[model samples]
Target: MTHDHDHDHHDNDLDPMAARVRALETILTRKGLVDAAAIDAIVETYETKVGPRNGAHVVVKAWSDPAFADWLRRDATAAIASLGYAGRQGEHMQAVFNTAETHNLVVCTLCSCYPWSVLGLPPVWYKAPPYRSRAVLDPRGVLAEFGLVLPEGQKVRVWDSTAELRYLVIPMQPEGTEGWSEDRLAKLVSRDSMIGTAVALAPEAA
Candidate 1:
């Protein structure tokens, strides 16, 4: 922690991994093996069709309709396809509940295995080792740190993600959303809702 040298460089000034990627790109271009179009296609596919926005739509529909919610909780993949946004990573998903009695926590111990179809990119903190390690062992304490303290006697279950099935948090619908359309309701389903850290946004907030 000693900073005696007058080298004017903050610790945040350098991201070694990004710099390495840039170097690799230069090397690849010099070797004439990089295909920019292929990379663009892959990025576009994930950004548009394969990410969490698709999941958000499904969650919204489920919120607006009771039957859809039952189906989603039972079989998320098929339930999601009931609306047409079904393929790839979303082929297998499990909707976990966060109720008054039990709080469900999700973490990928080895890597960030998120329900991308509903939740965009995983937040930096979600991929942090501290969260992955502590979320399972002390769920209540971890939630408390995120400003979500549960009532007394509430239980918590943390699901460690694997390759077989993805996980999404089915947050309780916020108050004052009666008689809203599926499109309007979908707008309130933020990424945090799927992550279980925050409740769904109220329709009025939109």
Candidate 2:
């Protein structure tokens, strides 16, 4: 490859993050801990995360109030907005509830279109090609990859997110707590749970 023209842009000229990445990559490569070619391959496959607090609140409310849950089911965008959380990438939202017989998984097959307002940021793996394809082709297998194994008779349904719409999974309420407070229940909702890669944690686990 030709580096003749690029050398004019020195390390100091690079952006802070770019400079740091270059430095780290060089250090790892020289130490034999990483291969530069492997690093390139990783970069080639990667396309493009946040805390799930907002989505957790939505899940908590759904678990605590039946009316809100019904509203979420009928119209997730307006329901989520009712709680004062609405913005770009979350304009059109759909809530898929996980039931005893069925599980739901969300993926953006085209690109990383996510419900940022509610779910925060999309995970890096969510933007990768393998997950986008396999999510729809083999959702159960994908869930198992995330360490969630559904029962034999249970079915897995994949929701494909697009530029205009996104999905949020409402996992079933865990057992052993009939009157758990919303705050307590919120703790049981993992980011992955709302993504449908896993179920809500049980009370003991929570």
Q: List TM-scores for all candidates, in order.
A: 0.75, 0.77
Evaluate all candidate structures by whole-model CA lDDT and list the values in order.
0.75, 0.85
Cα displacement (Å) at residue 32, model 2: 47
With candidate 1 superimposed using the best TM-score fit, by how many Å does residue 203's alpha carbon deviate from the native? 6.2
lDDT of 1: 0.75
Write model 1 residue lDDT over 1-206, tens digit each, in one string: 57676688654544789888878877887798886776678789777766656767777777777898898888877886677755454348888876778766788888888776567668999999999888877877778888776678867777887767778887767778877787777788777667766667756677
Steric clashes per prediction: 6, 0
Q: lDDT tens digits, residues 94-202, model 2?
A: 9999999999999999989888777777889998999999999889889889999999999999888877888899999898867888788889999899999889998
Candidate 2 residue spans exceeding 4 A from truth = 1-11, 16-50
lDDT (0-100) at residue 100 of candidate 1?
A: 73
Error of 2 at 152 (Å): 1.0
